[model samples]
Target: MPIDPQAARLLAMLGAARPTDWPGVSAAARRDGFAALMRMAGTPPAVASVSDVRIAGAAGPLPARLYAPRDGTAPGLVYFHGGGLVAGDLDTHDALCRALAAGSDCRVLSVGYRLAPEHPFPAAAEDAVAAAGDALGRAAEFGLDPARVAVGGDSAGGTLATLAAGALRTRVALQLLLCPALDAAPDTESRRLFARGHLLDAAMMARDLADCAPGALDLADPRLSPLRDPDLAGRPPALIHTAEFDPLRDEGALYAERLAAAGVPVRHRCHPGMIHHFYGLTGLVPAARAALADIAAELGARLAMG
Candidate 1:
């Protein structure tokens, strides 16, 4: 099927607005570029009644924004935003986080872990794991049910969410992955089919991997590439979403396959007419809103299960 008209328009808009020289810019410049992208893409930050707090991590403090639902303290999700692990923060994802909180009837903790290039490879990964630990460790303080905690993210954030699920090993109630770039190496059919003009270009992927990895990351390391994990045992249930026109689509689908093969209960969806980062385009994309609703329904059901 052809791409949705909205997706086509979005792609054209993105092409028109893309920076002329992003590949040669400083990390800070790259960060600013993504911030602008978020602004161009959707609604501004919602009134997050949720307070901001810093969690203790191995590398210092990891900042997080807490969004409590209208129902009060409930199950919660630790949501990481996608910016190639080099950009994006809580501010960029605040609207989506608030929507998730309201729709899922769960507290949403928007994690602001350190980005790469400056932090590099395992730094962001480690901080994510630590933040999950910190969240679980202080569940009572946050007024959340420890048994109902889940991990969720989009793109790079989704990859981290999955890694956190695997690392936590039953500590997380569920995993929500939205078009996650699970494999850094581009070897899948989706990577070939949707390599360009889908919001996530192959060149951008290469640039991000190069910046984030530097010399410390082995692309095949299971920590960096969850698809490389030989064992997916003991992980929690997961809901993984994929966009048909995303280079990362197959990796997300394949990871779901691997999870199911390992006996993890999984629900996977491939939106055939959508593109990468569609989940964050809820303001302008109808499919994006539906996707968010699906996630909210799933998370609400799972949270109620406990």
Candidate 2:
């Protein structure tokens, strides 16, 4: 199938707006640019309520935002935003959180984990673990059901979520991964086929990985790349979402396969004609909206099973 017309238009618009010299810019500049680009994607749908709070992290007090569809206890999801673990913040993903909370009828705790280049690898991963612990411990205060809690994220955030799930296996209900970057050393055919022109290019991905892990850590380490984990039998059920035109597409699908093979129930969807980060562009693309709805429905159903 060909690329969706709406998605193709979005890609072209983004290409025209994005600076051609973005790759040569400093990390801080690139981060700001990326945030600005996301802000212009579309207007976020209104949710019941959104509040700011702080959660204890491994390093310090981590900033977080809670989005709820209504005022009451409900299933909760500890969500981490995507920016290659280098750029995104709570504000960057506020809209998506709102939509998820509204659509899924689940409270979403969006964590502001420490970014890379400043904190580095295992730092964000550690914070994810700490935040989930805090969220679970304080589930009552947040009006969440501890037994129905789930962990999720997109891109690098997805990597952190997977790590947290493995460490907190049997505790979490499900893992929702959207265009997750699971393989640190991705050598899939999709990576080669969509290496450039897509929203996330090969050069940008390499830079993000380097920034996150500046030290001499093995890329194949399961902590850095969950796909390398030899044992995934006890992890929670997973819902993996991929994009047809994404460089990370193959890896996300592969992770789903591995999870199912390991006896972990999995639901994987590869959206035809979509690209990386389309989850945040629901207002611009009908397909994106449909995908978000499906995610919300799945979350609601899975969490209700508790």
Top TM-score hit: 2
**How accurate locally is residue 220 in candidate 2, as Cα lDDT from 0 to 100?**
96
**Candidate 1 CA-lDDT value:** 0.84
Off by over 4 Å in 1: 20-22, 44-48
* Model 1 lowest lDDT segment of ten: 39-48
Please provide, for model 2 over 126-230, each residue's C-alpha lDDT reduced to its tens digit, 9 standing for 90 to 100: 999999989998999888999999999999889989988988887898899999999888789999999878888888888888888987889999878999899
> What would the TM-scores of all predictions be?
0.95, 0.96
Question: What lDDT score is found at residue 295 in candidate 2?
Answer: 87
Candidate 1: tens digits of C-alpha lDDT, residues 1-306: 888888788789888876555577677887887777676446633433779988766589888888887545689898889999999999988778877887778888888998888888888888888888889999888868999999999999988898889889778999999898898775888899877777888877778888899875678998779988999989999989898888898898899999999999999999878888877787778877777778777788888898
> Alpha-carbon error at 292 in model 1, in Å?
1.5
Alpha-carbon shift of residue 268 in model 1 (angstroms): 0.5
